[model samples]
Target: MPVADDIKSSWADEVELEGGALPPSTEVRENGFKIVTDYKYNEDEKKLKIVRTYKIEKRTVSKSIALRKTWKKFGESATDKPGPNPATTIASEDVYMQYVTSKEEDNKPEDESSIDKLKSLGDKSVVRCRTCGQEHWTTKCPWKDTVLIGGKLPDDKKGPAVTTGFTNAETGKPGGSKYVPPNMRDGAAKRTDSTNMARRDDTTAIRVSNLSESTTENDLEDLVKPFGPIQKLYLAKDKTTGACKGFAYIHFKFRNDAAKAIQALNGHGYDHLILNVDWSKPPTHSNQ
Candidate 1:
């Protein structure tokens, strides 16, 4: 490998220079890196442009994640060129923000009169009583003393009279200032008679016995509903286990409907047990 003197001189004169100007110098620090941003404002167009430049040190990543990063874009991103697409990606704009401190009065306790005003406003709302059908609470109704039968008051009485068991020692008359139990009050017997009369008038109730433990009110309803319109259905269940207690009461709108249900389901087999259907008797109370 012998070279001529002219070739050696030409090679020594040829210096290797960079293609473009060197990039701007970056100040590297151990605590934190610096962010350099270039801002340009165009007065004619009323526009402000910003270009942020930052450096990030390369770190080791999992091989799977690196392979995923090298995968080709698919679906909606398949036609998109490299880097952020101007049509899809938007540059963030500066937003003005403010913080407000609450006033001392806002944290203070409300005035007593304000609370009373709220109570008065609430009272102004219509509140019809369920007992008397008046503009008052059911508990404060004037006719609350009267027994409610079928969501209605008895047509025969205005209200029950509350008696004070005060007796004159010589006259033997009931005019004492002592308190008397409601059951011992005067006219108590009349109230009981009215209640019993109401119950006796309902002759469409039927009793169903030998029901399965897993039976529910829905099951009984489904069984007897086809016979007629059901007014009420009561299934007796154990309080502890919440299971059927082998009996139930169903009140139909008409006696004929109840009779039909009894005829159909009396000997019917349900849950591997025979059903016993019969007319329900009004409950009786013993003096004891």
Candidate 2:
């Protein structure tokens, strides 16, 4: 008969001292290992006792034990080998990171920039101004000068909203639903492109806070330009005062480059404030 691994069964066996015949019907079977037993009976007190014993052989190793064995082997190999080269160690890490990034890109969507289209469509397409019936945005409209408000241009009205999505017969997307008068659209695409580009590069964006009010866009650009190629730099400003809000964002072309910037630039001293740099969180859509 086939036996289960490490099966141990126990039963009582009676052997009478004064019996006419000890039980001959008792039987044992299946014999790779012998059944061992011990008996204890009073030599002359007429008392009896029975005992049973079995041997156990465990075949499974514990996880901790296996881990210790692996560590021992690794340590032995390290003790026998020479130390690794420092330059090779750094280069290997860089190569490994590139491999990992490429694998991740294969599994995910291609990274895209918000300003890619804007870069493609520089000043080739000119926008017209709506306020003065000329080609310009409301802020740059010449008619703002013509509008008389107490014999002066009104402080409240800047100009007509920059027109976008409007198609023209010449050098415009065909089959556009609506046509914006050349007088109505000025620098609309450029403005929209900048806004979208500001929010698009979450993977490469670094949030910098505690900026001095005097810090300018050019200053922020120069500060981080040493780290990597910058895709965009936007310094938050108060609309009313047109001054820096003590915070800014910088987007680098690569995540690795952004990480390097964060490591090297965080807590670094600027003009008047120590910069706090970190990865920018993705914008919340609901708030916008």
Model 2 over residues 20-102: C-alpha lDDT tens digits?
23323222223433233323346674544343222334457999886764553354355432223233444333443344356
Residue 199, candidate 1: Cα error in Å is 1.6
TM per prediction: 0.37, 0.31
Off by over 4 Å in 1: 1-186, 286-288
Model 1 lDDT tens row, 1-55: 4567447545334532221233453433343443443333366633343444334
Clashes of each: 2, 7
Q: What is the lDDT of residue 16 in candidate 2?
A: 40
Candidate 2 residue 52 Cα shift, in angstroms, is: 99
Model 1 residue 256 lDDT score? 93
Most lDDT-accurate candidate:
1
